[model samples]
Target: MSADGAGGVSRSPVERYTDRMVAALQRLEASDDPNLTFSRLIDVMGRSSHRLLILLFTLLNMLPGPPGFGGTIAWTTFGIALAMIFGWPIRLPALIGDRKLPLSLLIKLSERVAVAARYAARFSRPRLKWLTGAAATIPFGIFVMAISVVMTIPIPFINAIPNVGLCIMSFSMLNRDGVGLLAGLVVCLLGLTVAAAALFGAFELASTAIESIR
Candidate 1:
């Protein structure tokens, strides 16, 4: 799982992060510790790398998992978003942080993410720096927070929509790709619109049912 850095040549952010992710997963796989907690996983993944964390979690949310997995990851992402907004170090509460993860399942999921990240790195490079720079962090955080909330809704097939957008934004930020960032923003907006419409429709349906019953 050790990533070859092409003999230490300069690489795009996506490439660099992909390497880090691969290496981290490798370490987890080789660790002697029987119990791998979420907090440890975060530490192994580099706690200071907020963009990477967001990217990883967003990707995880897109994958199939146990029941309620989507909501759990969405809330974790929400916490990360808040940390980004407040400029605080990322930390999970014990309830989540202490929770044990199935290492085998994580490795499997991470392998998929690594492959996709490598493919994305082929076309991504640092461009439109301002959009991915510090000035945009708060806005991006807020946007991600909104998307994460939408993802928490129990609406079937709804979580995947904004998750794709978030994953793009995260990848864009990691690679400093402003064009990609804008594209991600558009997708997020579209997702949010769909989520809102669905929620409104549900509310209306419930109200009509109540009236009929009365």
Candidate 2:
């Protein structure tokens, strides 16, 4: 929970992250602060220890239920986490550059990821690169994506996994190197898979229960 200037009781961790990031975006929307540049943001983001934030963001929002009702939460979270690190939101599809925002963040992030992958290859072995990276992503990604899918079913267990996935994915992409990004992707894909399977099973069970009642 947080206290805004008005001093009202703040929302939960998930809500707080969303509020802060959304507010940042709204401010950017109204601003002429060129210092709010993407390059600077990327540099600044890299200079910080945001790995913890990334992990937490994944855990809180990508779980399941009420807040996860929207399809856009994941993508929205993706945007803000990237924006925070780079002073603006971004995606790989937008790597070509936007008229209003700098593409430097995109370029640098990709470069860094590639560099990290190459470095990792030295230890993990070229033959097992994808497996190594994907392995890291799978455990976390499964957890998140599972929540995302489950949320779509309107279950209240982990109601905000969609947002968490986006937040983590955003950081993974913005991280500037293949290793981290790939790991993040693993987390994403696995989570989605689990979510999908769970949804299917739940539907089947529900149908069976209904038939028996009839």
Candidate 3:
């Protein structure tokens, strides 16, 4: 599908980019022509937004775990995450709840996203640093949401928030303060864990109080 310059129009959550990329690969080598070159593929993806890119990466992180266990939900989440960040439609059919879905395909697609993100790194470093650094609010918001999720678990939920490391690292990366980021990560990690413990304790205390009253 053709994408506009403002950014590619999003593909349906149904489409898996890995399959599309694989097809494109086949067509490129259909003839006796050399396989699609690296530079060629890079040219096709182009520069993408740091915000969208980070969001995609975050969602992808949700995979390989409890968050993305089901079929259509997993791949669709993957496809839509990519589309949101890269700004293009994927168009893969939904395989809702299909347990036999090909995870290797999704893994492969995840790798591609990383590769594209790296390419973005070449020229987008300055921009990424500037945007993220100046936008502390971004990380703060992510931190808040992450905290909310962490608090939902049975015990110590406050501390085990996924991406706590990544989110903390983001602020460091944003501020262009390597040392600060590193420290922030450690602090947030511990702080979250401690917060989780506190929450669990509080819950236990409440449950105990109710039991005593009952």
Candidate 4:
């Protein structure tokens, strides 16, 4: 579904992407199929698959969850990053893709993301087009892959940091906003630095504990 501008005005890229996401969510909500799997969700997203999946996974990573859930998301995102880098087809394994998602929870998450997208669309535009172009995919994929690895570390209270960057990156991609991509890159770097420091501190603490025990 296209978001046609009122009075024949053309919608911005940000607005268009946001509208696409909302429409996809609405379609999911309207579906009568009882078993809504990840594969089905991707099929519903059509050409928006890559961008929407990145957005979905990033948002899912931001949510609080039980032990090891962060690692799961991190690994999934790792695969996605590899796909982005290698130009491989994005597909989940049957084990994961076939798993059913709770429609209500999915809708709730999509609603939150949609609201954020709409708000961001006000300030986002397609500038610095070079950064969002084909040349940038390799670097972006590498950064995302690194961040995903950091997220998998059992660093308490740090899972959300990189994810915030990832969320921005996803939005920037959708909106084709290179300026936003630069901002997202900065955030990802900062998050990576913080995670590295935290990991270093953890090792230091462990070493101190071992010495004390000795």
Candidate 5:
């Protein structure tokens, strides 16, 4: 319930942050508040690894279908991704970060993520482990940042593609699966291409309309 303890006790590394994330969600279920705030969720989850926090925000933004508060969620994704890139602790702006969310959604999301993570973990291993190393993660950070940008764009159903990409990247990162990371990058690039085409089409249409009006 409280922030992660400060006992300074030694512990082994947990490669997949998803495990910690699942535990955090379960703990939140026991809270009295039906609606959970972002700050509160952090507290409940304790001082977990950065990877876990990033995964949490990214998954919430990647839910398929109509988004509950799409803009808010997208901005939160942006903030978290920026943090990852900058090597800073994740922090959302007060507006998006402090907002309260329905516990039902969080609970459902956590369950679905847990299921997906399990399946993904099976095929993931330490092969090409260098991809996850410190220098390599910078590119990964940029990849995540690009996904966040795509998610924040106000195009219909546009976010869905990148959502899949980010999910793949997230799972791979958690499992330390280098091969998965490569696969994810491919997916992410494909999604970016789609998004770019959509944007170009929209711009051309707008330009045509303006010229016609002239």
Candidate 6:
């Protein structure tokens, strides 16, 4: 319940996010490009935080509700993680940076992302303010990098967890909810632990098989 100087009501943070997300979706739906480039997609979004952009990519990767697009999603998330690590000033790579996405996919993704934004906005309020500030960036960067590594491993279902965590973390950041950020990090850690265990099990199984064959 933000105060408006005039008698009109001001939009809450979540409301603002919902509006922006809806507007972005409409813009994408109207684009003539059969394939929308990343840069162009950002342009359509008008202005957005880095975390929001990263979360959109994550959601798009999961929108089909299946594990696929290993290379594309992995690289995109990786680029975003790099931005987090090096601080916000760094730009994504120009080569794949401008990679294109289908208009149909964007339309589908926009709906899903908007829903998430709306949901997140409902609970988002200023809390645990310390965790969302500049002091927390380095530690958060480390966490982002760790999850980004797991994200690149080409495991579909396994990757979804971390992507979801990142989305939560990003939304929480926007809301300035430190508790939500902490919870999101916990999810990311759990996902990473699961990924690590699976990888280890696979490695051991492969080793035993190779030895038996020899």
Give the winner by lDDT. 1
Question: Which is the better candidate, 1 or 6, if ranked by TM-score?
Answer: 1
The estimated TM-scores of all candidates read 0.90, 0.36, 0.29, 0.87, 0.80, 0.81
Worst 10 residues of 3 by lDDT: 10-19
lDDT of 5 by residue, 126-203 (tens): 567687766765677766766776777878776776777777776667666678878877887888889899999999
Residues 1-214, model 1: lDDT tens digits = 1235567565667877876787787787887874677788788876677888899889778767777778888988989889988888789999878867777777777777678777776777678999999999999998888888888888888666678888898999988999899888888888888888888999999999999999
> By TM-score, is 2 or 5 better?
5
- Report lDDT per candidate: 0.82, 0.41, 0.42, 0.75, 0.67, 0.68
Query: How many residue pairs clash in model 2?
Result: 33
RMSD value for candidate 5: 6.0
Which whole-number lDDT from 0 to 100 does residue 149 have in model 1?
83
Off by over 4 Å in 3: 1-47, 51-148, 151-168
Better of 2 and 6 by lDDT: 6
In TM-score terms, which candidate is top? 1
Identify the superior model by lDDT, candidate 3 or candidate 5: 5
The better candidate by lDDT, 3 or 4, is 4
lDDT, residue 88, candidate 2: 38
lDDT of 4 by residue, 1-214 (tens): 1347687755666556556766776777776864577667667765235665777778878767678777877777777778878887677778666756566676787777667766787788778888877888888788778888888888787666678988898789877888898788788778878887888898999999999999
